[model samples]
Target: MQQAGIPTGSTRPFGYKDDKRTLEPAEAAALRKTVERILTGASPRAIAADCNKQGLTTTRGNGWSKETVKQVLRNPRICGYRSRKVREFNPETGTESVRVEPVLDDDGEPVKGQWSSIISVTDWEAVTEIIGRNPEPGDAYNARKYLGSGILRCDKNGCGSHLRAQKAPASRKKPEGFFYYTCPDKRSGYGCGGVRISGPETDEALKMLVISKHEEEAEDRQATGVPEEWEGENELARIREDIDDWTERREQRLVSKERFFAFLAKSEATERRLVNERNEWRRPVLRAKGEPIDLRGEWGDLDFVEKRAYVEKTLLTVLVASAIRLGGPVRDRLTPIYRGED
Candidate 1:
């Protein structure tokens, strides 16, 4: 049964079908998108809030939470690998412990499962790096209170540091402190230290840009289509089989040690190239249906967290130039660089 490659559990995985070998299209796409978001520095807490706001539920029909999202992100099953819990008894300590580990093949590689992967194995490992990170302190995982706090960048000549949200010193017009975006001199390391703008004004201007850009992309995406299955799958399998065959031949003394090693290196290099192409070809399709036509209308009711998530999904980074004057339109010193830009 261990080598049969059949999923033993009755419950279907989050993004797969009942058989556990077929993808649930919508759920799989969502999982892929979530992985991409997490890899791009979206906090799990913020993602959970956004999921709940959209009335989305898990495969078990349970409401999303920070832990649940993290659990899914750390699961290797999403990337087409099988894992099992092995119970061990320590005679010296007289204790029993259970731990989960990925099932490996003879060559010490994780056994690939039947279900299509939502993301590449490399991406899954990258997401797992967040497991030990402190979400409160690190800029990548830290949750921002302002819409463009960490998403906006300093467009200085050689410095492209992210801007932080902070309060301005109290003044006559403002009783309390004024909120604005500024490049952190300490954090930026070598920032030019001249980029600053009103937080409220910058947020307003960026919000419009995100919505307008999203609508424009959506219009173009309607004509785009997902391609057929990647043709390189067979090529990849053949390469692996060739590797195993050569490995066996070397052990049997049919080839010289150096010759076998050189062949093995070349095989691994070709395999890597094929795997890269396969991964890029299988990127999650961006469905045009069910997406909001105008995010501006929904902007009024959204809280700060939701607004920030919306902006992150649409814009790659908003580059803010140094203010040229005392006061002007927020759009004047701002430049928006949307996602997918070269």
Candidate 2:
């Protein structure tokens, strides 16, 4: 077994060292810090860059890459556990694989502490499952598709400045085909004094706003000294445990011919809450994995209403003073309403 890449002794091999042994507390802490950095908004590439900047070496003594970072994340040893499998290839028969049962104690639970863990077992599972999703274009539903659309309103109290479109000619020879947005209150007999911006110009402004907002949020997180990588492992573990307990209770009631409806309701409620929490975590991860918005490319895919909604959501209202009509296609000019922090 030792000659076949299997350990013969009681000690387990660690990736970080040439001679494998259980991780010491200091090594565990370092691993945890690395995991926390990855859990934050940083991409694997970014994490690798940071680690290299700090002069840290991987188990192979080489600089870390995104692939290496991902591999480490997938390692079960990080959860202080190990897995075993046996593979066999036959000439007559197809290749076959077998997983040896875990070296269990009297209670049948797998042994623990084979290595250090950056995150808890439960949290690690959640993160790996998330990493398995498709990342190609059109595989994700982006939430920031709306930037300058009229649907986005001032988050302030009682100052909901409405937006409306304006039509203008692109050239002297053409009669129409350009459009823009402005404060609807300016024409609705309200006291909204705003300027007009061209449709294309407004689109550009909204795109800039979206990019700027992303930057601002990142900066805020850095400024507050907050731990960007929160350990959701506990919450996830609790949710799973709750579901299992509820399910067992529900089954017992049904088997005993007693009222199982109450147990069923409790289980359903717990499951719903867990699902909601999971979705919340998933949305940001999905967004982070999404491609950057291509203003020109996406325009042809959306019509007036869809474009408007996309703009409204993506832009900060203050950045869009108003949409004004400029020379372009027939429906060009628009006035944008900007409600800054006055």
Clashes of 2: 43
RMSD of 2: 12.3
Model 2 per-residue lDDT tens digits across residues 14-53? 2334345445555566666555544443345555666787
For all predicted structures, in order, the TM-scores are 0.56, 0.40
Q: lDDT score of model 2? A: 0.49
lDDT of each: 0.73, 0.49
Q: Write the per-residue lDDT of candidate 1 for residues 1-342, one digit (tens) a residue.
A: 444445777678888888888899988888887877665445676677778888889878899887678767766778877766667777997877654456787776887776788888767766665443222222234367778876899988887988888787765366465688988785547566678889888888988898788667666666676555568878899999999999999889999999999999999999979876664444333233224334555566556666777788778888999878777778988888877788
| Candidate 2: 10-residue stretch with minimal lDDT | 131-140
Count residue pairs with overlapping backbones in model 1: 0
- Candidate number of the best lDDT: 1
Alpha-carbon shift of residue 143 in model 2 (angstroms)? 19
